[model samples]
Target chain A: MGKIFQKPEALADVDTHYCPGCTHGIIHRLVAEVIDELDVRGRTVGIAPVGCAVLAYNYFTFDFQEAAHGRAPAMATGIKRVRPDLMVFTYQGDGDLASIGMSEIVHAANRGEKFTTIFVNNAVYGMTGGQMAPTTMPDQITTTSPAGRDTDEVGMPIKVSELLAALQTPAYIARQTVIRAKYIRKAKQAIKKAFTYQLEGKCFSLVEIVSTCPTNWGMTPIDSIKWAEDTLLPYYQLGEYKTPNGAG
Target chain B: MTHEHLVNRDKCKGCGVCVEACPKNVLALSEDVNAKGYFPAKQARPDDCVFCAICATMCPDVAITIREIADQAPTENKGGK
Candidate 1:
């Protein structure tokens, strides 16, 4: 009756290394809260990626494994196979999941790995000085794409959620944002649903979050929200692209 | 008197996302820096707070905790023959 909202017990008391206005912290907190609600804190294991979220291990109280660049899905598969009872997830960014590690993730999802994957698509390689990632929006300005991304040369940003949803494997795939409060609610629900699907042992799950890089985007935190809504959301969109047959 | 919040100044990075998300405009980033040399968000108008928790919902750091006052119960008599 006294507490309305507080940090989840599964989350650590340490401050994250994420930059100010970065949504990675929000996503981490959501995952922690979901883990808390599922009562899987003791059994859960997270695979940290090589990008900006490399230090993701410090934010969660659960166990974590640092994987080589773009090898998180492969590592998660190994851990889940040996210990199927343990809940497992991978915290990967666009550069780690959609680009260099695309093969690993594609194969893992195609094989229907029994684990959850949180794909954070901020549209650029943040840790590496905001290089042009495969998910980087066309016509967007990045360090590598100095004169704005050229659609003619690079095609279009990869829609990883939709691409994975096209596979026949029974999996939960969703893309949501946390730019605003309303979006945060939906994003949390999407994440919770992904974890729920994995808990049921029904299928693999991936929640592709369309995030923002305020520092890299050269915009203030508040302005980044508007830019993400005006620029990023139109291309990435939002909604659950796929769900298991029994998922209702 | 029932509604309140504790913002962890040390953990907060002065992102201002929570301040922008507040519906009642009761929160503001402090001009003075904290131990970490970052401006932490604080309640500017506590009486106007409705405890919507929108700030907590949007906070990336999970530094804000919203709470309510709990009612105290009367002492029970022990000498029950």
Candidate 2:
């Protein structure tokens, strides 16, 4: 075997604290692999946000800054404004980006900040014990919505990529998943494009990763992947919401 | 036979799964810590490898790669490794 798959060198040699079958680990590896391939590991600066992946700063080999909950966009904006030469990105969760950080994310996209954002959407908050997230599926049971999320009561899940694509400032926006190899390959391509857009000085690149929360969903690791595919994909729909070359 | 090993010194976060994933007992915790100050995973035995890339595949980081050791010859290429 001439080494077909392994961890990328850009990642830190530490075990992830994410739950088994959690999509956070997969998303992180994808971003790190992108950095390695782009050869921007040395100049990249990632802003780590609150929620399950708040500790993401410890996983990547690049320089990192821990921002307040729902404040990663602001932090990344400031960093990029000051250090325009650096490749800046933010790693935010659905709870952090779609919920309280909603204002910041919207403004960042509106202002067209030249930064990359890896938005992990597991439909629920995974760090603070599986609470209902803004992206939570209709009737998806969570700690707050134990009887499943009622769309009539809780409203429908917010389509972040679609909403952001509507904004003219953002240069790239995409929604992808990591439940299987076929999707994973596409997600990697999307991630690489987002980074490439950022390197080209394009504005507001975001990759919304429809992820899995095995512990919160009350399913085994394998089952969680299946649930994400069967339940989440129908709503999220993996594809490029926006692209620099005008390709969707 | 070719052998594969994954190394993610910074991404290891000291999870120790690679050490357990190896059936050949070829992996061990490194004594030298990385920038994160975590003991990274290391190859305990390189020569005994049967080219099983399980350690690399099992890695959450996907940080390891299996390579064939060729003598004074160019390495074989793959589509993606």
Candidate 3:
């Protein structure tokens, strides 16, 4: 018998605590796979954000550092600057990256820091009981926005990839999804490219994965994928927002 | 001759993601529950598996492992060193 599929070595053997159907597990696997493929597990320093993936350190076999809410970029920047040989990446959710940590990410990207970011955009804050996040789509109902997100009052959801692309610094920015197998494959390629860019010391790179929050969104795991495909994909748009030297 | 999927019963959370993703309907939630009190996914129709590995990709818990076995014996090497 020959093995066809198995867990990546970068990931720990322990089971994840993520909610069933939650795409966080998928994203985590992709990151770990990328790390393993790049052979950077020993030299990689991951900064776990203060969100649902806050305990991300417990799942990965490599070195992981905890960061304050929205402060992952700051921590990653410091680590990368001091230890240029190490590959540093930040795993942050929509709330941690788009809201409170907005300035941190923007400035880090603007400075063209050599680091990678895996931004898991599930729209609503999963750990905080599905509160309205900056990436929450317009007319999307969350615990904080029970009446649905009013674009007129709060403005439209922030397109983080596009926003970062518009900056003057040279960075690799892309938006992908992991709702299905096809998208999952593409997401892994994007993550691999982001890490590869960092290894080359090119510039700041980020892969914003438009994910689903089944438990937080009050929908079954299957329905959440459908909803994300219909509502989230249209608004968020999946593609490379920017790439260094015009390479996607 | 065919591929088989091994599901880690205790790790599976009965999410049904793999069940829905399997194009051949090769997997289903078992009636028996695991230690976690959730029905683990099982290979209901192992013969239909095409080794596409879609279920393994969709599994959130990394519970599925696919392996293919060769039915025929390997031919002996005719060339000597």
Candidate 4:
């Protein structure tokens, strides 16, 4: 039979150790494919954050550096500065990026660090047992907010892409999801564009992918994807928030 | 023309899913184990190989690649003659 789907070469030969049906695998594949297409796999250095994807280095064949929680942006900045010739990218989750790392991300964007960031926004802290995050939506239930997130107590969900776009240093920023085929295609394009921006030596570029957590969300894979499409999309609309050339 | 399913013996994890997925009945679990000490998938009939990547697709460890051997210079070519 003709090929339908096959794993990319950028991924290691080991089976993913992530929980089955987690979107982390999909996001990893997309980044790997983009890296392969850019032909920068050898020169690329990815910073894996302190979250569920902390072990992402083992999944991909490229050189990977581990970063502290919410410190990937700063780490990436240093890497790119020291080795400007090497392609630097950071893979961070919502808690790692929008929560404790917010200051680093904001300053990195303000400085135009010329690096790529793949932000996985599952709306909850997957690594820390479903804790509420800065991007967690109102009325959303997490382990810390079992009664559902109350805006009055925790404040509102931060529109990260919009907030980052307000900074002048960012060259590209987009919010996309992988809940369905249509959004998956858009997410891939946004990821590719983020890498392209880095390849062109542009300022900080980020693509926040709205993903699902079936095990943590207490829903099946199908329901988790549906939840992201139904609840998260409305709060985090899909679009290019900022582009240097004014082209998405 | 000939086809061969080249199993990267080092990578196979003794996952029997591939052995159960192959439709041509050409693949079998090897009695000999690999460096990993797993029963690697092996071809029972090299001549009957159709290069179906089903085994590769089912292999979560990505230890398989089916390669097709191009037919050598045609002994008798109907179109050319």
On DockQ, the leading prediction is 1
Output the lDDT of residue B52, model 4. Answer: 57
Interface RMSD of 1: 1.9
| lDDT, candidate 4, A86-197, per-residue tens | 9999999999999899999999989999999999999999988999999888988899999999999879998889999888779999999866545666888999999998
What lDDT score belongs to each candidate, Candidate 1 first?
Answer: 0.88, 0.81, 0.89, 0.80
Ranking by DockQ: 1, 3, 2, 4
List runs of model 3 lying over 4 Å from the truth: A1-3, B69-81
Q: Per-residue alpha-carbon lDDT of model 4 for B9-79, expressed as tens digits?
A: 66665555466666777777788878767677777655555665666644545567654446565223111
lDDT of 1 at A115: 93
Question: Each candidate's DockQ score against the native complex?
Answer: 0.51, 0.22, 0.49, 0.08
Which candidate comes out best when scored by lDDT?
3
lDDT of 2 by residue, A1-248 (tens): 25456568888877777764466777888888899999999999999989988888888898999999899999999999999999999999999999999999999999999999999898998889999999999888899998999999879999999999988889999998876656777888999998998898988899998888878899865677678878999989988988876757
Off by over 4 Å in 1: A1-3, A246-248, B71-81
Question: Which is the winner by TM-score between candidate 2 and candidate 3?
Answer: 3
Task: Quote each prediction's TM-score.
Answer: 0.94, 0.80, 0.94, 0.76
Evaluated at residue A41, the lDDT of candidate 2 is 91
lDDT of 3 at A15: 86
Give model 3's share of reference contacts: 0.71
Instruction: Pick out the ten consecutive residues of candidate 1 chain A with the lowest summed lDDT.
Output: A239-248
DockQ (C-alpha) of model 1? Answer: 0.51
Give the per-residue lDDT digits (tens) of candidate 3, residues A54-138.
Answer: 9999999999999999999999999999999999999999999999999999999999999999999999998989999999989
- Predicted complex 3: CAPRI docking category: medium
